[model samples]
Target: MAAATASSPLNLLGFNRKPIFHCKLSSPRCRPTFLMPPGRVPSNSIARTGRTFSNPPSYVLTCLVIPPPPKRQKPKAIIQFIGGAFIGAVPEVTYSYLLEMLAMEGYLVICVPYNVTFDHAEITRRVSERFSSCLDSILGSGLPDLGLSALEVSDLPLYSVGHSNGALLQTLTGSYFSERIPKANVIISYNNRPASEAVPYFKQLGLVVSQMLPVAATFPVNSVVEVASGNAWKLLLDTAETVVPNYDLKAFGSFMTRFTDQLPLIINELAEGISEFKPTPPENLESIRELYNVQSTLLVKFDSDTIDETDQLEETLKPRIETFGGKLEKAVLSGNHITPCLQELRWEVGNVYTPADALGQVLKNVSVNDTRRLATTITNWLDLLSH
Candidate 1:
């Protein structure tokens, strides 16, 4: 019959090509169908089929959901306080008072107990020994285990605040252990005298007399008088020259005036006690000399009366601290050195009050903000490392 055409057979099967059905067609008129081999349909071809397939666009849908990132961890901060001269005899009430204030501000503060002997030589030795022990304790007990526990050491910050002699001790300790211990972000010195000039004038005079008097007495009276006076003048001159360069005399003057004024009773007590003063030993002379020569930081917080002296001391120390890559920040407080511990007695109508309250009030006024800021700074630093 007519020549078989490709279009005629494909149109009848409803496919582009003829379907191969190997079954009877007369009894059932078999329906033609096309089977797609596995993976035979190209992705592009399936995509092109689009609406032509039985499944419509609305019949199937897909979506992706990404969870938000976790929050970061914050760091921990530690504050160490070194107390000042004759701190041992002073009641622990003041220490506890300060601790309470700092604790209220959410600071973990350690009040370090240092050597507080009246003898400078003994004080120096005890300071050195105690400081070393404290440092060892910090590294061994606290720092090493900080990261292992809930508190991470890597992110924690360390700070130190010292008062009077304690301030001097901490400055020396900080200098000595600068390379070994963790860096102290903030170091506060409270009412501290310079270590380079801590020795009193009377002590210096005694030291000179004990050292040079033997050589002078083996001469004529006039000669001895002349020689002794000359030696005395020389000693005084030398001491002045040596001590002036190492200390801020203007600051010292202010300190002496305020200290002498604020605690008139204490000064009176000291003056009365001076009548029983004894001579310093010859063997400890060198130690005394060394103490005056050692370099350390000096911090003095100023009240209304100490403003001028505070300024002078700050100006004097600024250049020196700059040279050492350090800084001196001066602060003025609303109360004197004895207010923080004494607030409880502010409204005492006629009751007798201990100096502890006054001392606490002063400390509270001076250190409350500082302690809190230091704690927050340390916490922030620790948090950064955890992230």
Candidate 2:
């Protein structure tokens, strides 16, 4: 048997010594001491001691300890939306239309902003950070006081929606602050891929790593890495769409035509950019993927004309749909992506709907199972907020 070296013990009773160990110790000096005043006790001559004393009551030296108060209950719900790329170029008309629709049906919605002008890496970073901050704001800002008679009160459901790059932000929101937000009733994502498939591909090359192994060791494959790459791809696609001419022309035209009258409002909102926006990426991929288990529905609308390959888009989204146990609520309207945002759709593009009507449908749909109902829920909620 090989004897253990003095410095590195091999075994003790067949048990190898651990490389590191920890222990806890208490110091006598740290103990508190109580001393009575010299004059409080009478002098004693029996043992030639300066003073004699009786034992003090234990209660006299004990201090009362109070526990901290419990945390307050959070709001009933929180609604957040992620804005697409393009500085201040949110689908405002659609958003407003949806908000008003939801407000009418009694729900609160929050529109989140993301930095689309910056590089992809920067945008991803900002999306995560902004989401965290926005959640903090919503938690801090008490629920919006919707003035309604008690008789008309109802348990307003909370939901979130995101379009284009905004979908990434919504993913981050669900991943990072699920606990702080209300149970998401619906998550309507428009024209975007899942974050796991959109983030990582944003950069031209994968992230570099430095290690001390004899042969360079790489970081273990993780969900974050995969999700980041996917997110990157989505961002790249969005960037290309914005600059590439003739890309989704019909949808672009529809968005422009419908909101052309609200250009000033759109421009003003864009002017502020991410100054009023907050949301951040999730701490890890598992957190974001957990959103699939949430009881929320997702609707993905594509303009068949603008999308050269509809099958490709469907394939890309298939996994996400299955993961969430959700069916892809799709609309293949005659108009391009922009058609859903136009007034012709009666703003139903941004709001939820029950019957799943065409662009000309009115805002009369009202069943949760119906597309029109979802639309009404969104429109009514938006109407509750002024401006």
Candidate 3:
């Protein structure tokens, strides 16, 4: 079979994988999904809208939790993983290889996917709170007894793991919500740039395109987002089974139907958030020092990532971690910022090795062994967490 592929890709980002939600439509099945656009206070969204306009379309913090290695009698640790940028919203598909590798090592992996938004602080809190609630629900023995309903990791060390933008959130969750996050944070390809730099280049392209429009021409942002959403789902449909873990194509039609239904409302949320910044200070620095209780942080930086802001993060975190005797470790891996986003790609040659194998090899990675190396490195790091 051929490896999962993207056709003339949009560089990176912009796929809205509808979650298998019995809860909310926005979050990825295990999670809720919402795009908070710029300037909107995420808290204000929760302040309960007008009596008529309730039930805002947004993501809840549901996560995909894969059980530990099937053969292992006892699991080693539990990982709370968040991805970066737009791909972060569909981490099970985008970061499946690395996460699956971690799972095979007897780590119970919980992957939290989030929509892209300027309100990182708000999004982080949503992710953090939802993770707590999701974990409780999973462990509470809820109705139907889902896959991992009976499993218990209460005694196991809880590690906060993240990639790219997720690294930023994990750092915050480790710091702001440090009490609940025992063990340490495993931050990979950390990025914490402000709104301008943080937003995807795809949105930036939209801005550029808008500037070139005729003076009399007017276009709705919803239409633009809709077009983008359509293209993204197309890509997902083509590659789901290959990239996403055990994805069932039977759900493809339903997924597309749901994505189309939610696109307009998601766009409306984006439009409404254009000018609302009620709960200001988009980051949490005031109380993290005092509340920062996590024992340590492992910062992973990529060699070729010019956009990576882990150095700045290191400067901020090193002092805080060492203030009361905690370790702030660092590692520079080889790859671009998206190294951790690599998915497993292989083509079973029908008769003999074909040119597609060469293509697969190229598409597998731009950097040599970055994904597997990352998985092994993180595995070793998490193992050391127990010591």
Candidate No. with top TM-score: 3
Scored by lDDT, model 2 comes in at 0.34
Sorting all predicted structures by lDDT, with the top scorer first, yields: 3, 1, 2
Candidate 1 residue spans exceeding 4 A from truth: 1-75, 88-92, 118-125, 131-135, 138-155, 175-177, 180-300, 305-313, 343-387
User: Which 10-residue window of candidate 2 scores lowest in summed lDDT?
Assistant: 58-67
lDDT of 1 by residue, 49-152 (tens): 11121111110001000101112122234455555554422212234344334433433344444323334444544544543344333333232211222223
Lowest lDDT block of 10, candidate 1: 58-67
lDDT of 2 at 355: 56
For residues 1-387, could you state the per-residue lDDT of candidate 2 as single tens digits? Answer: 111111111121332222111111143322222332211111121111110112111100111001111121222233545545552233333443433333334333444443343233445455545443433332332223333221121233344555545554454454444343323323333333333344443222222211222233354434434444355345654664554423343333333332232333323333433222222222323444444333333434433434223334334444654665443333332333332233312123436654545422544222112333336434433332212
Per-residue lDDT over 96-172 for candidate 3, one digit per residue giving the tens place of the 0 to 100 score: 66777787787877777566555667777888876776665544442122233323344456777888878777766
Candidate 3, residue 78: Cα displacement in angstroms equals: 0.8
- Global lDDT of each candidate: 0.35, 0.34, 0.57
Candidate 3 regions off by >4 Å? 1-61, 142-152, 200-291, 354-368
Find the number of clashing residue pairs for candidate 1: 18
